[model samples]
Target chain A: MQQRDNENRLSQEYTNSVLLNGTLQTPKWWPYLVSILGFFVVIGFVLFGIQIKYGLGVTGLNRPIYWGLYITTFVFWVGISHAGIMISAILRLTQAEWRRPVTRAAEILTIFSLATALVFPLIHAGRTWRIVYWLIPYDASRGIWPNIRSPLFMDPIAISTYLTGSTLFLFVALLPDLAVLRDRTTGFRKGFYTILALGWRGNPRQWKMQVVGGILLSALMLPIFVSVHSIVSWDFAVTTAVEGWHSTIFAPYFVIGAVHSGVSAVVTMMALMRWGWGWNEFIRPEHFDALARLLTVVATAWLGFTFLELLFALYGLDAPEIALREMQIFQYPWNMLFLTFLLTGYILPVPMWIFKRIRTNIALMFWSSILVNIGMWLERFLIIVPGLARRTPFVFTWEAYSPSWFEWYILFWSFCWVTLLMLIFSRVFPLVPLFEQKESEVFSDDIKIGRATVPTIFREEEE
Target chain B: MVAEKNRSWGMVIDTDKCNGCSGCVTACQVENNIPLNDQNKFERGRVMSWIRIERYWEGEFPNVKARFIPIMCQHCENAPCEPVCPVYATYHNNEGLNVQVYNRCVGTRYCANGCPYIVRMFNYWEPTWPEEIRNHLNPDVTIRSRGIMEKCSMCMQRIKRGERNAGDQLQDGEIKTACQEACTTGAITFGDLNDPESEVSILAKSDRKYSLMPQLNTNPNVVYLATVDPYKDKNLGEKAKTNEH
Candidate 1:
């Protein structure tokens, strides 16, 4: 009884400290970082405005490379969004306790990254004003139905569904935490959390419903997350003329690839939060150890899928396919980037991640995650550009495309946009779920081993 | 109705007669109001040529050979560019022309990528016409706006004008495309394939006729007559005689 009382006190103290972070004064660098990112975000918008006013010629998109860095960035961010549900939903559903501290930060990652991605279709459109024609369901004015067959139509539908579903999931899980803040704080802060809390008094039924609702939402969103990236891949896959794009394997290849990058991004984000916010105790190295093991398996699968695509290309021996492969190897101006993608994405990470020491090192996890995402960005570029370079059999029209300043600026600025929104969001919301964190510590007990006590998770098991 | 179903507008290019000339390219620019490509645009691969003449150099130094082929929109029956269009901006029309709806295009450029012919061109900038050149712009065809995808229409404006002028029925040789009109060597032939009596139908059936990248199964309307080589013929003749013997 005395030890149990001590355990309850320990859990209570940990909960209070975590909860107090939400009420802490805004950090010094917060506004400064926001301002700088906000400035660049403005610049991105201005550049897009210029492109819209002057036409796509302002960017270096020529005849064949109709989709350029804009599309690559779009796919990258959408792929980043998959990280949230994969880490939060799948792990939570499996009852993994490591997800507790990371859940809120990861789910918001989905919201902001997806928000950033949604801007690209508008930015890259040839006629920005006429994009509305695609949104209008009825075809009466346009004289033809928006082609239901096109993967372009599926993107908006699937993305919006996932976004709305995930947002509701985030808010519903957030209520009990908000209720805690409401009871403890005063002034405008009290009123704000109170209304958002929706009058929850930590009632048993409300908690029960919140838990069940979260699981149901997670169940609903899993397929949505998978299909979203698959449909994004189809935008390239259905176009038979672009040699490397029309692939039978693209759908699964894209989904698994997305999962790899998304999980790696979560690891990178957790490492950043550990250092930047000094949340070391909460986001421990042990969390990254588990994540790195997952990353190694995912990277191995990705490597297999990538090489399978290459083998299929070689098998066809089709002229366009051969030409595209040759260009990727020898002719791409950014050949060094491809080499780096192969090294960091598959070659280096695979071997390094196999060792538990490298996986457990926080600094290595940080650097490796960043390298993996960079490799992923290049992978998206390799998938898009080379296919268009050797687009047709006509030798005269076969031309190379290099992204101009506008593309680079927009891509960099989009990163800023995502970072800025996440920073601003961090200031207002609870980064870690107070309720779940306390519950995890309360449920777990140390079991007596031969020489040491190991944590034995005492909870419901799969029947 | 069956007769209408059999009607396929097609083109035949006799590569044997085509000299390495830029007249057809020039005439296409003038007639279609395609913007004059500056050096910067050409360097950037933004050239707006609707129909272009491609020159291929076959051999080194002494036996140097340059082959000129006039390439344009093939208007394929199963066009790779068609179904991929989200807005249906480009599709095969009833008359066999692969029509591009300039106004309808949101400029995703999927059609440009899906085109194996590399024939589809995008307007990078709103095409600027010098004041004097503006006055001479063809009134029959729309000057495509910037941010729209455009390509050779097979002179659809002329096809319509000729059909309208011909009243109830169309006549053979009554209509011709700008490229055909500008080809001084009589290399380009355009006609209705449904009319088996037409010149294009006869040439399309020729032993040497072939479509570009026929293995892709695009069923392109533009058929090419392989260029006849005198030096290669002697080698082929000796091989054929040996096989017979």
Candidate 2:
């Protein structure tokens, strides 16, 4: 028993050293990678500055096609943020043990992606400086309350609420880890972790409170998780003026699409985490296998929603709706994008994901997950731009949108910005939660039946 | 100041009389201080004309006849653009005008997306005028800065001025919108629809009158008198099939 305890302690020490490497001891490539991402992020901010100084004209926006790439990327990032709630909150409620290693990275992705998503509307606006009037209720003294009736108003409210909740959820899960960092570090790092740790002592009472807080937050956040994407979908769905936009299916369609893309993004992040940190033991093929199985189910459901949306769109047999769908599907460029969206969004990756070999292959999962995002981004683009570009009663205004290079650069910048934030976050916190890792180690056991031994995870029964 | 009066302002366009001259388009641009729609603007699909004359071909190219309909902000009673504006920059005013408060507009362009007529135009760039033509700009209208939405106020400046001139008992013919004033064929008529004696009110009651995209139920104040097509009956079957879709 004493020998077993020593072996367990040595294993825990190895786990701590490996997970805490970034915070405790810096990696050689960390600074270089951060600088490169930071350089691009700064350049993106400058380009945005130039865009603001000139006008929205710098982008490809026109009279009819008022929204383009910015809005598309906006919805894309919002969709990407569904990773956190899906992995941490939903899986926790369902008592999924494999969620232990990935919860932090997924939650961090949510926070950063959401922060990035919130910026698109302001920058996409004609008057970015004056967006405060739309955002704030400060003008109520003039008897003009910000139009609560506006979906635009609801968007900010819903998004900010989710951001706040996610941040709290992240921080709650982070407390024990922060306390660990505090004990291990010195000087400024120690001070930083000390304040953030909130006097977490690993006492029984504190652990109980932490667990209760996490569970409570997860339960509370489930509604917000559903509402955030639903509201985002409503922004497009409620607009009756756009041919393909006014749909009842948008809410469920967007939510499911978000999960498909978001989970894929998490898979992509997990593959990168495994490779980049060399955490082979922690984030294993089994984890990827579990995520792939979940994704196969998610991607299929999303495909169903996609077809259902199309079916309902065509159900009315409305001439304009048919014309829009035709241009979206049969026309030269849009048809190509539609094909690519279908291939990458579901057909290619989902089929590959069905096979256990591909599901367990890290390299294949990474590339496939990246493809899913590209397809998801195209899906949003296809929805937004085509609806605007559709033939109205006035043929004179029929025109196609081509995103400007500046818009493309800005889109590129958002990716870099999110990545930079993630890298910075990793430098401070373990991407994989340490406490959860230890818990998993403690909970893991092997049982023998006759000559066969099988691995199992067990938790203590609640009193 | 004009005494506040309950007036439902409206417009009636006689498509039969319109020669597709584009006089109203140019007149509205000048009157509203709309940015010069240069070739670059046209190519980019960002032209800022407050009103446009859409010409539709009625038949095969050999026997084709052009039908012109001047379209503008319908100033709908149930304006889709109004409620969607987060800043309340666009709203229905007491004078029955669909008012677009320029300064209040932060230009989310949500209102533009909501407008089925697609009348709302965003100032994609700051409005500029050559030094020689700078004085020609109408000082009565505010020069909309880049990044805000502007649309046909139905020449609200003129309506306010007309009301201020006429005081308590404003006459129907007193307010002539820029489009009406410039229309050489008497195609465009503007007046208070509340007055039964108004020319617009009488024209709006005509059997040929219709509103654009009536299925959307915008309930527009701008009424159009359908073109008196001589060949309409000859192609009735084709037209019916087209309408059925």
Candidate 3:
């Protein structure tokens, strides 16, 4: 009877370890789904090879419409990447209670989106090999450095700074989580976690240091992300071309758009993780409701900007401005796409979020997120092409641009690449940061409130 | 004394004489060895021309009158594009020309953005020239590839060659840009602005001449004489008579 009791106790301890650690018992379907995603990732690589060999001619870009799908994707992906900083830094600063389980997923979006966004400027360059020239400062040998006055010079600086800051912030926050994985795993996984954990032994001083470093990096990244998109908007706003291109409101307009798309992306990502990881208990309806509320606010701001831009254009009565507005509303072939973006992307999402059923429905949220991305891309296209096509004092020459097959393949591949990265990362790291979740449960308001109400906070501990 | 003779080159276009023929446009392309305007690109609204004519409509519907304005780099005295470049690929020459050095450009596109006229065009893709067409290429001018910015140079090579010839013969006012030579009505004139007696200088001083966006204070080297309608008085009188009838 004593031997049997000892055996039972050992088995119970093993089961409890597996449940708490979240590593020893990953879902059976996880590897299979990852492999399927990897297949598309390889396809994207093959397409990228073709783009490098042929040139930008592989895409649908031409004179007057010099930018197309590549630039649109660049802005959209970059905008989507903003979610990580918003979720992690902004919410933490505000002291939102729900951010504990959500921050890791948000940070992953930032990493993957940035990785995807970097490919565009290279693909858009006529001579990809000469891209290094943009990096080198103007010297006697080079004759001149990049003009200090040009937004083109500012683009690379802003993007690189944001990328560096965000990557650092992501890695720093992952350290404690890595330590947990190290203690729980063995073999090659153990080795991977060991190096990544930086030998963190979870000492009191180490935890304090990790938290401080992570907060500092997050603080730095918040403004860096805002400045990144503002500078990009200036790339167009600084130009003296079509009326819409020269607007002063572009910086804030772009930031709101970025947030609109970014929050939607976060919603989609969270939904996918909840379903895949069976994280129903932790992610719950309350989290979805909170994200929905945020989305509604972003959508409202986007609508205000849209109306404000229109009002200014109409009030100014500038000829080029009038022409561009006409083209966007009634004349251009893609006007329908623009309308869809405004209605479905902005208008529809707002009302839907008010409905509790619609907000919590996983499938509805996913579809809405997808529409928001499409809408954002349309917004980028509308901003870049129409203004350039209708510059004043010339016979309006309307140029029709159609992206080539190579361009389509590249875009498709980029989507595959980002998705694959997210999947691989999900398996390698804990999708939900276990340490953070455990802490939240321990120090939750329910426990604190119970202690305050009873005036016996140490009673449970003594018991 | 030499500097005083030809310190600044400029052009003065008589809009009254311009028939909107686009002769100057094609002529500049041929002389400068500019790339062909691909149809696919044109449809996409990307047409690369060093110089272009802009038409503005003054009124709505039947009363509408189209005003044609030919515009290029104003080659401003206080050039907005000059100060913005982190790299000094573009700068003002001693002769008051806005010079863009192709080989030196890293294609940051900041200069293009900085220029209010939007004259700068970026090489977004590799320029393709067929084997036979390559023979027509001028050896004096370097071909620009992708990742470089380009703009109007006021036919600098032609000006230089003409100056060299004039120096050899001890002559003056002997060189002209392709546009000036191609103009049947003599609407376009190019010469050293420093020479008070030069045709361009005299025309630039005309009462009808004005510069576009003068309020911006760019001090553009390019000047234009406003188009005069010969039938303006007749049309007004006829309208008055019709009203009386």
lDDT, candidates in the order shown: 0.83, 0.90, 0.73
Preferred candidate (TM-score higher): 1 or 2: 2
Best by DockQ: 2
Residue B18, candidate 1: alpha-carbon lDDT = 96
Evaluate residue B66 in candidate 3 and report its C-alpha lDDT on the 0 to 100 scale. Answer: 63
TM-score of every candidate relative to the true structure: 0.94, 0.97, 0.85
Q: Write the per-residue lDDT of candidate 3 for residues B28-104, one digit (tens) a residue.
A: 77777678788865664556678877765554466556666666677888787776554567898888899888876
Superposition error at A441 for model 1 (Å): 1.4
List, residue by residue over B64-141, the lDDT tens digit for candidate 1.
Answer: 677788899999999988887888899888888789988889988878888888898988898997788989999998
Ranking by DockQ: 2, 1, 3
Candidate 2, position A439, lDDT: 91
**Number of residue pairs clashing in candidate 2, backbone atoms closer than 3 angstroms, sequence gap of 3 or more or interchain:** 0
Off by over 4 Å in 1: A1-5, A19-24, A185-191, A331-334, A460-463, B1-6, B235-245
Residue-by-residue lDDT tens digits, candidate 1, A371-430: 899999899998998877764646778677778998999999988998888887777777
Q: For model 1, what TM-score is found for chain B?
A: 0.92
In candidate 2 chain B, what residue range of length 10 has the lowest lDDT sum?
B236-245
DockQ of 3: 0.38
Compose the digit string of candidate 3's lDDT tens values, residues A260-351: 88888888887887777666656767678889889888889888998898887788777667878888777757588678878767776778
Model 2 clash pairs?
A: none
